[model samples]
Target: MSINWDDLKVALAIVRHGTLSAAARALGTTQPTVSRRLDALERSLQAKLFDREAGGLRPTALVLALVGGLEQMDAGAFSIQRQVAARDTGLSGEILVTSLDWLGDDVIAPMLARFGAAHPGVQIELINGTRVFNLARGEADLAFRFGSFEQENLIERRVGEVAYALYASTEYLQQHGTPDVGDGFEGHRLVYLDRAAGEVPHEAWLPALARHARIVLRSNGLRAHMAAVRDGVAMAVLPCLLADREPRLRRVALPHPAPVRWVRVGFHSDMRDTPRIRALVDHVVGEFELLGACLNPKQ
Candidate 1:
C-alpha cells in the first residue's frame, strides 16, 4: 500500500509537539485519532518511528531522517497554496490586523487610515489587545509583535525596534524626586504589567529595578499602566513611542541602557503573497521605516 500523506502529516505534528494530545490540538483532531494514524504509519513503514520516554515521545533516528524531507514538502505545499490564493484577482475583502492597544492612538491608526483611503475596496479590521493574536489559526490576518518568533509554517519580517524607559508623571517626580542611577528604586512605587501580559523581554528586567520599590499597581494593558502613571499614581517603564511624546511625563535616565525590542510583522506562510495581506505587510513596513527613529530612539 502507498504511504498516506494524511498519516504522515499526523506523524509530523506528533513529532513537533512530542505528545499525541498536543499534536491533536495542533491538527484539530482527537488524541485517539492521532494515535491511530501514528500506529498506522508505523505499521506501513514497518519501523518504530518514536520511543515513548519519561519526558515525552522521542523520534527515532529513522524518523529524524524523514523529518527534513517532510519539512521541505510542507514548505512546497504552503507555497503552492499561497500561489493559488494569490490568483484571486479582486483585492476587495476584509483583512484583520492585530496589534498592541497603544498603537491605536498614534502609530498604526494613521497608517491604517491612509491604507483605507487608498484602497477603499479592502476592509481593514484592527484588533487591539494585550495578547498576541494567533495568525496560523486565522485569528488575525497579520500581527505586529515584539521579540523573536519561532512558530513553524509562518513568515515574519523585522520592521523596527521598540525602546523602553522608566517614566513618571511630573507631579510624582517633583514630589518624590527622580530615581538616580543605581539607587535600587528606593522610595519608588511602581506601576507594572501583570504576569498575564508580561511576555515581553523588557518586562522581565523590571523586577530587578523594582526589587526594592513597592509595586503599587499591576495592569495587563499598556493603556491602563499609562493612565496610572499619568495620574501620578506610580512610576512605570513605558515604551518610548508612547511616553516620549507626553509632556506630562519624564523619562528617567538609568545607569544601564534601556531595553530594546525587535518589532516583527508576521503572517501565515500560506497567506504571505495574497493580495490583501501583501498590501498590508508592505504598507506597515514602509510606515515603520518612516518612523523608525521615533519608535527606537537612541539610548
Candidate 2:
C-alpha cells in the first residue's frame, strides 16, 4: 500500500497530541483538516488507526507500531532540509527567532529591529511565547531563552542576565504604604504572574517574599504586570532593565537579593557558516552590550 507522507504526518500528530483539536494546533491546520487527513491516512492503510473516546483519541495497535518510524522520518526530513539550506552563503534570507514574550519586548525585538535596519535584505520573524523552539529540526533559525542549551550540534552564546525586583508606581506607594520585607509584605497588593506563563525560575521567589500579600490580579504578560503597577493598582516583580529607567516606577526595598536569570542565545551548528546566522548573532550580541550592567542589576 502507498502511504502519503503528509497524511502519515497528520496521523503521527494525532498520536502525539491524542485529540484532533490538539493535532490541528500542532500541525497549524484546522480541526476538520486534521480529521480529514486522518481519515485519508487510515483509508490508505486499510485499517482502523484510532479509536475515538470521550477522553480523547487512542491509537490502535497498528498505528502505535508506526509511531516510532514516523518520528524518525520527520526528524530526518528536517535535518536534511536545514543541512541543505545551511550551504547558502547569502546574507539576504528569512530567519526566525523565538523568545519569551517579555524578553522579546525588552531585548529581542529591539535587537531584531537593529539587525533588520542594518541588513535590510534579511527578512526576520520573531515568535514570542513560553514554548521553546527546537533548533535542530529547523523549528527556528535562532532561539533566545533562559538557561543553557543541551541540544546537540548547537552553539550557545551568553546574551545577558535578567534581574527582577519588586516595583510599584509612586501613586501606588502613596495610596498603600510601602511594603517592608521585615513584615513579609503583609497587607500589600500584588500583581502576580499567571501560572500559564510556564516554568519561570524566579516565579517562586516573589511569592516566597510576599508570603502575606494578597494577589490583586494575575497576568500572563509581563507588560500587563508593569502596566498595572504604573496604574497604581498593585506592585509586581518586574525586570530591572525595563522598570529601573522608568521615572514613574520605584524599586521596592527587599532584604533578599533579587532573582536573576541568565539568558542564552543559540542556533544549530549546521548554520554556523551561514552569513545571515553569523550576522544576526553578532548584531544581537553587540546591541545587548549597549545595555551593559543594566541587564544585570546590583544584588
Candidate 3:
C-alpha cells in the first residue's frame, strides 16, 4: 500500500481549487494528468474522493474525512523541505527569485550578471511579475518588491529608495504644454498604473500627484506606461532612473519633488541563515553603493 506524496499533493490541490483545471494550474500540470492521478489515488485507497459536479469537483465523504490529515502532511513536508534548505552550506543549486518586470530587468538583472560571473555554480531563476509569490510556502526563495512584505513571518530588508517624478515626451509637452504643479494637471492628460499591478505606497501617490489630471490611459505595466508617455499621448509619474534614460521624455519640474518608494528584499524566516540565501542577500545589500545611483536620480 504505497501512496505517493505527489499524488496526495494533487488531491490537496484539487480540494483547494475545486476544479481539475485549476488544480492542474496550481500543480503546474495538465488537466488530464490531474484527472488520471486522482483516479489512481482513488484506486489505491479503494475510495472515491471527489464527485463530478457541474459547478466543480466536489469532495466526497472519504476526502472530507482525510482532508485535515492531508493538509497536515503537506505542511509537515514543506517544513522538512525548508529545514533541509536552511542547512545547505553550498552556494550551488537554483534559487527562485521574483520581482517587478522593470526592476528585475533594469536593476536586478545587471546585478545578477555580476553575481553570475562570481558564482558560476549558482543557478538563478528570476520571475518578473506584479503577482506576489508566497515565500512562506516556498513559492519563491526571495522577492524584491516596492513595499514591505505582507507576511510578517518573512524576513525583510530595505534595498534602496526609488525616486519618481512627472515625465512627458518633448512632443507631448510641446503640444499640451508643461503642467503646473499645484493645478493638478487639470487640463493635461495622465497615464496611470492599473490597480491590478498590486497595492504599493507609490500607487496612491500617482493620483495625488495629478489630482486634477484626467487619466486617459491605465496600464498594468511600466513598460506600457512608459511607452504611452513616450508616444506623447499622456504624461505619467515615472521612476527617475528609468524615465531619465529615455531620450524622448523629460522630467517635469515642480515645486516639491515627486514621491519616493522603498525597495525591499524578502525571504522566508527559515532561510535567514541559509548560506545561498545569505550570500545573495549580502551581495544585494552590498550593491547599495551602485543601487543608490540607479535607484535615486540626481536632482
Q: What is candidate 2's lDDT per residue for 1-299, written digit by digit as tens?
A: 88889898898888889899999998889999989998888788789999989998988999999889999999888889888878775788889899887788767898898789888889999999888788987889899988789889899988667788888999989988889777778888998867776657766677767788999898888888989999998998888888987899998877777788888898998899999998888887777778777766664
Candidate 1 lDDT over 1-299, as tens digits, reads 67998899988887899998999988889999999999999999999999998876899999999999987876666566555645655666777788877765567778888988899888888887767765655567778766555766779888766788888999999998987546677888888778676466766777776578889888877888889889998998898988888999988767667888777888887786688778877887788778767665565
Query: Best by TM-score, which number?
Result: 3
Q: On a 0 to 1 TM-score scale, where does candidate 3 land against the true structure?
A: 0.89
TM-score of each: 0.66, 0.83, 0.89
Q: Give the clash total for candidate 2.
A: 0
Error of 3 at 47 (Å): 2.0
Deviating ranges (above 4 Å) for candidate 3: 195-200, 206-212, 294-299
Model 3 scores worst on lDDT over the 10 consecutive residues at 290-299
TM-score of candidate 2 on Cα atoms, chains taken together: 0.83
Q: Candidate 1 at residue 86, lDDT?
A: 50
Model number with the top lDDT? 2
Task: State, as a TM-score between 0 and 1, how close model 1 is to the true structure.
Answer: 0.66
Report lDDT (Cα) of residue 54, candidate 2. 100
Per-candidate local distance difference test: 0.79, 0.85, 0.83
Error of 3 at 296 (Å): 4.1
